[model samples]
Target: MRKTRAVLVSAAVVLGATLTIGATPAHAETLAGVFREHSECERVGTRGTDQGWWDDYSCEWEGRYRYYFLYA
Candidate 1:
């Protein structure tokens, strides 16, 4: 009975770890979405002459300029 309990506990721990790891990507995607939504480009303008445009134009995370993490 003691061995069975230990095995169950170990299995639970492994499952919890797997779930935590799996959740990390989802959390990252959410965070990236929030970032993009709040980014200067979207809040300001794409054109260089627009107010706050310099910040957006210079940003690397702008959707139009970004190549990596496409889903994000």
Candidate 2:
């Protein structure tokens, strides 16, 4: 019975560590959307945080459009 319990605990620890490693983001930021207006981009990025999809966001201009990025 002790051996069986030890094996079960070891398996649980391994599974948890795997999940933690897999859940982390490999990159700092990823593009969420692009908009023609700055306000619109900010609005959408704000909504994303409010909805709990992203922790934080930033915007940048490329050409005539604004790009939105969400970072973990």
Candidate 3:
């Protein structure tokens, strides 16, 4: 009764704090890596002109399709 309730509350608190400490740092590290890659691209002239989310290699072949499109 009372002992079970106290145990449950303590367990919940511990789990929540553990999750928070583990997840937040990973998210922050990912964000920092993205920013670093973006800045590196800016420094160079390799900015991919494509804006689609699933175009894996479309950026590097920007102008190559114009001639080949007539054959397709």
Q: For each candidate, what is the lDDT? A: 0.47, 0.77, 0.38
Worst 10 residues of 1 by lDDT: 26-35
TM-score for model 3?
0.37
For every model shown, what is its TM-score relative to the native structure? 0.38, 0.52, 0.37
- Candidate order by TM-score, decreasing, is 2, 1, 3
Please give the RMSD to the true structure for each candidate, in Å. 9.2, 6.4, 13.4
For 1-72, candidate 3 gives per-residue lDDT tens digits of 999999999999999999887875522211111222333433232233243322122112225432211100
Error of 3 at 8 (Å): 0.2
Per-model tally of clashing residue pairs: 0, 0, 0
- After superposing candidate 3 on the true structure, give the runs of residues whose Cα lies further than 4 Å from its correct spot: 25-72
Per-residue accuracy of model 2 over 1-72 as CA lDDT, tens digit each? 999999999999999999998895655687888777788888888899999999888877776443433333
Where is model 2 more than 4 Å wrong at Cα? 1-27, 64-72
lDDT of 1: 0.47
Ranked by TM-score, the better of candidates 2 and 3 is: 2
